[model samples]
Target: MAETKGLGYELIWKFDMPTTINHIMIMEDIQYGELIRKYKVEGKVNGEWRILTEGESVEHKRIQKFDKVEVRGIR
Candidate 1:
């Protein structure tokens, strides 16, 4: 996996090959206090986009799990 840091509001990752994923973890820098309130996770499965999961009130970190699915990309 690779990560690029920037001041953007979205992140998109495309794998070199299809991969099976079940969970994702997100973290926030809260030195100034919690700022994120809601978020969503989408996966590209079978060449289509699907909503995998969503949640609210993310203080420092969040871990979201869903049914295993083979995906080519995630955002």
Candidate 2:
């Protein structure tokens, strides 16, 4: 292979959220005081999610359908 060089990036991604949102909580008669709480489990990666691009937030990055991501749950 020829001399190829550049920087790569690594990250961890969590896809699935834990408990589904169910109810809304209302404060003492205050308008816009209704609070929505959703329970979510902290997802973790078994390994680093590596990207060839440099210094990029992987959000919305088009990974291959089968791209390897170490996640604790299904999205």
Give each model a TM-score: 0.86, 0.16
Q: Please give, for residues 18-57, the per-residue lDDT of candidate 1 as tens digits.
A: 9999999999999999888888888989899999999987
Q: lDDT per model, in order?
A: 0.85, 0.29
Q: Best candidate per TM-score, number?
A: 1
Name every residue pair that clashes in candidate 2.
none
Clashing pairs in 1: none
What's the residue-level lDDT of 7 in candidate 2?
A: 29
lDDT of 2 by residue, 8-68 (tens): 4222233443222222122233254523232222223453332322222223222323333
Report lDDT (Cα) of residue 75, candidate 1: 87
Give the Cα error of residue 38 in candidate 1, in Å. 0.9
lDDT minimum window of 10 residues, candidate 1: 1-10
Q: Give the C-alpha miss distance for residue 57 in model 1, angstroms.
A: 1.7
